[model samples]
Target: MTRLALSALLATLALIGVATPASAHTDLLSSDPANGASVPQRPTRLTLTFTEPVPAESATVTLTGPDGAAWPTGEITADGATLTVPLAGSASPAGPYTVSWTVESLDGDFVDGTFAFTLTAPATQQPPVATTPAPPPAVTSADAAPTTTSPSAGSTATLDAPPTTGTSAPAATSGDGDDGGVPLWVWILVVAVLSVIGIAVGVGLNRRAKRGAEPAE
Candidate 1:
């Protein structure tokens, strides 16, 4: 083979060797209620299946009802292929609910996400339940960032995440304040939306220019 071909083959082989196997420590393969699934009946228990065996320790499942209160339940358990927990029958009212969970792999990798569903809805009126959270590895990576923080050191980002406003936003009418006080986040969102629109317009104009440069067919 030519020297260039030989080098390319070696590089490809190295890349294949460096690729990690697909044995992820843990990931939710499925759920009984299914994330964002709607059902007429309230589930008696919450069942979660993972891609691989996850550790029993430090695993938490939250079933929050439409009332914004925590659903009371027994301790969560990890079976051979699934983690199961009793649903809070007491407060599982007839409305939409969210089940968020945080789990740790035996390797200490963490994952977290939320799914919503509804009870007492008509058979055809079930709200859209997401089959799963956005995705596994992505959610896992987001969860890992919060834990990697060192308590001994200061964390500006942690504190910055919370809203900076000292008071709740008033009705955004003309009478709110002298200059019509607007929330900082609202202004930021407006700027962001404008920026996106501006970029999209620029891209469209550039594409039009490029197309116009082409000769007639």
Candidate 2:
């Protein structure tokens, strides 16, 4: 009877060891966008890895921004021991953010926890520049019209006369005047008449002196 009692005690100890592990709750092992990390930009999704598998339908995640606004999340998905959920709507303001999660483990026990991270300022962007064009060039001397000059008062040619086609000798003119003087033939004819008159007078006087000498006889 003592040996039978000893066997029963050993069986009870073995059962207790098995029950202890099965009744244990799931624990979070690691996370993406890990706790206490500072990221340059907001993450698109949140992923949680646990020590044991959790049901996707029973998982619930809530994100709260620095402004105390409750951000929405998409449908939760499970892959082995990991749970992932997409973020919905626009990004939150830069500051600290809190992530709270609750899930049902394989042992049918509900577990919940909280973690926090920071969202730092992102990189800045700049704008573009403008441009302009140039102008054209100016007019040159080669593009001007042709010109003609008239003769002065000293010149013999008149303004109304048409231009001659061939070379020709210049006409004779009187000194210091536009109208001409007397001709050379007129002065020669006057000198010849004066000589004829003087000769005739000398012949007549000689005849009178000879006749007076003859009359005295």
Candidate 3:
């Protein structure tokens, strides 16, 4: 009877866990091109902002243009909520440029999104680093203008099908469940099952003690 109780308890726990929901870190925010800023030329770098700080080397941001090409020079560099990417050349002929990014939130869940900005005109030259001419005011992209970004033919960011948003859903993982990733339902189920086991053990021991005291047999 005690064993049956334990088994039933375990089964009940599994069902409860299934009924509950799970979520991932969300797509919180960004800060590149201010969402709707106009640029006269393409800048040498692209930057993105997030609600939480991301790892310096763990985040990736891609910039593509209207002609279906990639513009990012290298990997992104992170500092707090900021992630920056350098441009390969100046920028291609302008229109709208798309900046898509994937970042690992402080909670360790990856979230991604794509946003775009319009460029008015070509930049004559890339911006100089801190070493030169007071560094071109830093107001906007001055060198490359009237440019746009689009997905290249073989770019991974390009969607053959439609893109699925990275909402609060938890993605299945391959590691042992303890990736600090036990779901809320998983934890609750574990606790309930343990409690039932404790109760059954207590009741079974009490019944055994009572039976041992029988008068004749």
Candidate 4:
């Protein structure tokens, strides 16, 4: 049989060179905010890198938001030839951002694709910077009061004025005999002395009369 048909065509050319690198097909060696990139922030995650080794629930990612709105991805990991996912909320609304994908190629083949990116500024949650509650601490005159200082021009400032409440002026009663303002008891004493003097004079006269009568002198 001609050397067995040349050993069956060298065993079909060594099985088509070993099945052409195991039937190739798994190429996409770099992505991740690439592919038309113009991102100023809006990419939480959506990697891709490949060239073999991607499998584990295969993969599928989708995110579209140039206002057509459908941005939801999460849970799609392949970590070996990189796949990644996660981009769920907040930060996807400023223009261009597509990134669709589908992967399962380690020779199982299912490779889908699409890519775009240009978020130039999509992260505006700035209304919280409006916290203006700090204007209440400025009433200061040294915190409002007690600072009086203004009396200097040949200075004579005796400000003790705080006693103006009503009538008061009556305290001198206790038989008031203060000599120059003499009253009551002082007059009574003077009368008593005069009376004593008169009594004494009378007594002396009586004695003299009695003696004269007894001796005719």
Candidate 5:
């Protein structure tokens, strides 16, 4: 009986050692942009690596802005032991940002943690150096308008202005005998008078023929 009791006690002690470690909650091993680091700019993604693999659906990461407002976040993805939480929208405002994360370990236990970091407004950006486009490379006298330099007063050299061609003016004619023949109006009037005389003669001949054709009475 004494030997059996000792054996039982040893077995119990071994079982307790194994069960205690198994039932313990998971722990965070490290983080990207590490805990308490001073980042020059806000991070777009937060990474949490754990001692064991956690379920993606069971993971939740919340980002709190400097003003204590909740920052938007996208779906969290679990790849092996790493949980990647994508930050939605633009970078968090310049100041202290807080990350709070909760995850369920493979053993169905919930583990939660919190971390913080500073963002320094990206160094003021320097206003982009303001390139003035180099002022279009000063136009020289030779390049502008192609001016021809006149000869100096004491020098014998001379540059004459280029001769301009003049277009000839239309010919001018005197009114006398300007028309080569009789005027068109006079010819038209003569033709009209002749047509009237011809019509009168034809009418007189028709009346005489009717008189001759009548029977004697």
Candidate 6:
């Protein structure tokens, strides 16, 4: 009976040891921006969520950015099952960012973890500069001189022309402008009307003369 009791006690002790480690250790459930996530903009803060609540003072977080520079952060805070670390300012020279964290759960178990995430390059803005298109290079007297030209003695080409005067005949009208000539179809219609009127007048005169010739008829 003594041996059996001793064996039972040992078995109980083994079970208790196994249960303590399992309950004491906390698991990292998730993180802000997520682990191994590619972020398109600079992240101002980091958040970590665990399977269980962790003590605020026992939590520690460190960050490394591109070029392995240490990123400054504000005081860490804990709320229930989450921990948040705020960056000092906007991150620069975007690239890979690594975060290391350690926390002590409420059960006094110390847990540590590391994760990597990437930051997309920030957009660079180019301010528009007011440029007055370099004032068309000033025209100098030398530049205004006409290029050399040679012509045969009898050439009729002349560059000079008499100045226009108000009395001068008006410039020839373009095809698009009105010219005073009547169209052929209009003139034909006018001639046909005149012919018809002349024929009617002649017929009336003939009738009057015939009646006069026929006497009392």
After superposition, which runs of candidate 3 have C-alpha atoms over 4 Å from their true positions? Answer: 1-28, 123-217
Residue 113 CA displacement from its true place in model 3, Å:
0.5
Superposed model 5: Cα runs more than 4 Å off: 122-217
Best by lDDT: 2
Off by over 4 Å in 4: 7-11, 27-45, 52-101, 104-183, 191-217
**Given candidate 6, what's the lDDT at residue 116?**
88
Candidate order (TM-score):
6, 5, 2, 1, 3, 4
Over 4 Å off in model 2, which ranges?
1-5, 122-217
lDDT of 1 by residue, 42-106 (tens): 77798888877766667898888777988887788888758898865443458888888888876
What's the lDDT for all of these models?
A: 0.75, 0.84, 0.73, 0.79, 0.82, 0.83
Per-candidate RMSD, Å:
49.9, 15.2, 56.5, 14.0, 22.5, 19.9
C-alpha positional error of residue 62 in candidate 6 after TM-score superposition, expressed in Å: 1.5
Clashing residue pairs for model 6: none
Tens-digit lDDT string for candidate 5 (21-130): 88988888999768888888767788999998889998899989888999998889989999998888764568888889899976887899998888877434335676
Name the lDDT value of residue 8 in candidate 4.
Answer: 100
Cα lDDT of model 6 by residue, 1-217, tens digit: 9999999999999999999876767889999879899988878899999999888798999998888988898999999989999988653667888999999976786999999898887645568998886667888854454443456654444344345577868787645224766667777899999999999999999999998899573
TM-score of each: 0.47, 0.54, 0.43, 0.32, 0.55, 0.56
* Candidate 3: tens digits of C-alpha lDDT, residues 1-217: 9999999999999988866434336453766576778787776787887666678676777878878787757767877778888778654686888887887776677888888888888546567677555656554533323433455754334224434577867886766566766667888899999999999999999999999898984
Residue range 1-217, candidate 4, lDDT tens digits: 9999999999999999999988888877888888888978887888888887788486777888888878887888787888888788885667888887788876677988787878988677758566666666668543444434466765444444455459888986665665457787768888888888888888889998888789553
lDDT of 1: 0.75
Enumerate clash totals for all models, in the order shown.
4, 0, 22, 0, 0, 0
